[model samples]
Target: MTVTGHVKTAPETTAQVLSAEQRHADELAFLAAYDDGARPPGWALTPRAVVTFIRGSDGEPLTLPAERRTGTLPATMTVAAKFVGERSLVERCVVTLAGERGLLLVGEPGTAKSMLSELLAAAVCGTSALTVQGTAGTTEDAFRYGWNYALLLAQGPTPQALVDSPVLTAMRSGRVVRIEEVTRCLPEVQDALVSLLSDRRMNVPELAGTEEGLIRAVPGFTVIATANLRDRGVSEMSSALKRRFNFETIHPIADADTETDLVRRQATAAVERAGAAYTVDDAVLDALVTVFRDLRSGRSDEGWDVERPGTVMSTAEAVQVAVSLGLSAAYLADGDALDLMPGHLLGVVHKDDQNDRARLLGYWDGPVRRRAEDGSAMWRRLWDLRESLR
Candidate 1:
């Protein structure tokens, strides 16, 4: 099915990554056509369809009307599942957005919290470009609004002089606004969201008595913020700010097969984007993901105790290691990338803390030695490569 207006028409560039809206425009269009369920105010799709778009269909084909199947809109289109996690979580998130409530996703780093937020915003509002990246230095201007210095100096605090941040714009347009790493911001800076969320309005004293100063959020305005639980104690959210959001915790991929599949898919995409052929073997990816899971959980699959590293052994790190292994193979013309896994893992483990080396070595001495003795050739090879870690 050819979707006309919504699909991006720009020429494909190697390095550019399209937003969620542009990437799945056809699937969204298909769902919009097939289901005519009622949508909340300012939403592009119904709540149910939004969940379907994120969780994917059960291979059931969605048939469109014969007349509407013109250019890119085919007669039948199957929606591919975007998220690899729980369907109930996606439903809860969709319901929260439909109710115009703030949603906060907290998890260990690399659990795809940011990706989920982007997809949810795109599905509900038809755009995910409105975003605020919270950091230690993030000021109130980021959450509220800023003034155009030149316009403000010449005309004073007029409508044209007011510069809208993503939050303010989302309020006026009733769209989803994303705040990434909310816990990274200072507590005072984070508190700026309390009044805007509770009152559903942004008051600008600079332009008081003007129509532009008192900007009330329309019916569909909502916030989707993500925070890394690793930063739990640092710049923690105030009780008031926490009360405004419906919290959801995104756990790391539990099953090894699911994690390996996600790593393969994401790594292949990364490799292709780098203009390199994907040559990483499945066995190598499986081993890589297994080792990561073991290190992250501080236990071998067989229940041996392993010391966890200070660094986060997240799926994102696994994807990076896979991509690096693929790139090494592509450039060096190496036959198999399995041999490079140990070195990549060593690099990942020793990232921020020098003491993590000892913890990693503890893992190599315990789990790696045990797995080697268990008759797995890959584990045996990894065990032999333990000297490389020193």
Candidate 2:
């Protein structure tokens, strides 16, 4: 069996975003070889090793064999931490997956729940492509199976006529399947997983009495679903459905410095991908993150009260704002990147709700104005750009 799933080489210039498994294939290999601990059945790495892959190593050098040292994997490789949240939460998530219980990540929009799900699926099953994007239109077929109309018409309920959903494929292959925005699906549609999880089998009525009629989940097959808390009322999940999975609440980044670092790193990668030079200054980044954190929390670092907008002020949005600043600095080349931040923030704040603009103005009047009065040059410049919000 190949350690990495279907390794394929791509030209450097054309290589776009890779899945977590493909992008971190070497790292996974190194950890798999280094870790002598026993892993759950069908798992690519031990639970501890999986945590290390997600939370990162403690800068200690890994003792690698000669064969493992290739490309970026040197003799002493340190796994860079990917997720920026609490290590204990990740440990719990890994432990839940190790137990083969479905893991459901719930959080506000942009808290990286979906990203965490993808990382876990990749680390556990060596594949993260098996996924179902849950939406209002998501039906029972999305969670179980569907049929190829033409083939079904011609062959009449034969195996060839069956089209496997991601969940079914994961069941057959013993891989991890991701369901994004599970709450977005209608309640009745979302309950389709209740029996699938409890019974660990899916029955195809059309193929009854045949070998393929009943599909049983293989070892290591599990679901990792994510739900945005902001969409709670859109479609509530049933109690029976919620009981099948272990729920984990992913919180937003609490530390401004850490959030700023993440935004800068992601934005830099995005800018590089766009073939542009990243020129956003560190001071500008710090200022931008500070403003976002203050407004998001409805209070400044000094504990001053401010009104938050209805829109989610997330780290992911910060990355986009940073990327916009970088692009402006790269192409516009006319003003400081900090000068463009207020405009970008305004655009993000004024998304669907017009009342959010009033809330933004309140934030500016409360925090931005006070920060500028405190003689911070960055805040002073940001205060000057306040008129742009209007």
Candidate 3:
């Protein structure tokens, strides 16, 4: 649900939609009886089902749905999700949670770090609402507690005046807490976690005399933090702090077909949301994907050399481009949605810093333009529009 538009996720059948993880409540309880650690009541699945939920049952075998009704997960249980490649990275995340360790998801922008964190939290705890958006302005109070200003003025800072941070709430309730863009916080501000992770407790010394001092993390409690590799001035996590968590680095999509599937699926859904009929054909979508894939990897389909722009060529941006073109065609153009071509792409490639514009031009000089130079009419039209990029 990015930006509150017509964008939607893969529509799931009614059965696939776990209206509330409540459906899995019994199954999770069954697994918990044998679970080595104390269980978090109301959890959808034991840590195991939670793992299966995220790793997805793509290649795994399962019994039929009817025979294994009670205490059994679905046989056709597959999440029509879109995180590409690196099943091991996904596995590592689930494994880390099963160990009750904090999981820090690290990845390049657009590699789905935020999405994976969201999915992982949803699968593990069945809710993704407990999240903290980190910024340089983020304070230690964000990780622990703050005073409710009105109450504090009236009651003079009593325990009841305390307002809990999302992290504090998750710690107390034994749910997964997410700290998004973890690196955006200042180093001193980020250091506030040293005690939270090590002690597994938060102390509100302000209310020490009245017995509201410490909040303890119950069983099944954990934290999932996200950091984008592209952010500069990210506060380096201390080794001591890092030791308390397991780290999983998500890599970009490694397959063309898979990446293409992602573009087509996600983009089409986005276009339908814009109150305009979708008219961009598969050929246009494939061309957009191909351009992005080549620009991102610095290589063409024929194994030809091309220089990559010094920018983060993230898929999220690509999705936006497809959606943008869709909107442009839907609102302005009639019938000829595919005509957007290089003109639409100009808006995207130019935003990638100055050198990137040059790189895009360099890309144009080669395959992109060469195709225009050659007899391919598609490339010729795109080359004709190159002047608009300047």
Candidate 4:
């Protein structure tokens, strides 16, 4: 079905922010409250409901009437498809919320760590905006408190000058505070979390005389931090800090069909963003998915020898390729644009590095040629002229 084009607005939040239907589902989640984890101090749905909010409901569907939630209530959310590798890993993350422990998600880049953390924050807290990106320069003040210099000088140790970091706010409010790229921070810099986790409070030494000292963690207070395994040469975390967190390693997607579906879904959203209609034919879509699947895992569908590409064959990259092909046909060529079978994929496979080109050729010789011989015209042409690029 061709959707009429609508120019995308510059979203104040994410494009995938839930809609009205999801809003109903969210309230129903709290109403049903089928063990949505432990409730943070001010939170409605328990941590379990928060998990159900992010990861979709396997429970019976809700039939509640839709009503516009006017106040600044937590936006209803669902975990996206990118993190489909495991269920136990996600469960651990959700359980970490029930405790005061920090949930550290370590994985290779493009493993959907950041998005998962963001979704978790959104579901547990009312907003995913409470975040501190951990970089080499991330100061201890970022993890704790920062006094407003001007306000502090003017008002002394008053509450006005007592600027609260997300961590401090979460301690007081009992919401999930997210620290992205935990390994990117220096070893000592990451250690700022040690006291926060142990005491579940931040001592405001400067404001010692009044109501501003010792911000204690509320019931639902916890941290969700993401670290890339690929960022090894940079700042590595210390053992003590790692001990404070419940580590959940997010692995890459195992199934080719799952990845293909993710690529198609993400690509559609991207194309719709640019006001372009996505009409990718299933044959071409399957071919593109096949090429990606083969190159990514270093094995063919028939378990034949297929060389691995040096570059990462991430689902993020797959969406890019699919979006690219959709754009090329929608703007430059004729008829349905979806009819393009295998010609467009050749260039996408051969980019990033020349070694990728060699692997792609090997894939063509093995799988594409085999499929062609098995009687697919588009693949047959692709197999025969595979070396045209090099």
RMSD of each: 5.0, 5.6, 5.4, 5.2
Q: State in Å the error of residue 127, model 1.
A: 0.6
Per-residue C-alpha lDDT of model 4 across residues 1-390, encoded as one tens digit per residue: 233343233334455545322434445444333443446565655756655555555544533324533343333433233346565666678777766678988877777888788766766666667889988788888898888899888877787888889888888887888899978877887888998887787788887867767677878788999988754446877888888998888877788777778778878877766667677776667777777777777887788878876666666766777887787766665543333434445566665667776766677778888989999886776676675645
Off by over 4 Å in 1: 1-15, 66-71
Looking at candidate 1, the ten consecutive residues that score lowest on lDDT are: 1-10
lDDT tens readout by residue for model 1, 72-147 = 6789878888888899999999988888999999999999999999999999999999999998889999999998
lDDT of each: 0.88, 0.88, 0.72, 0.70
Model 4, position 16, has a per-residue lDDT of 52
Clashing pairs in 1: 1-72, 1-73, 1-74, 2-71, 2-72, 2-73, 3-72
Ranking, lDDT, top scorer first:
1, 2, 3, 4
Superior by TM-score: candidate 1 or candidate 4:
1
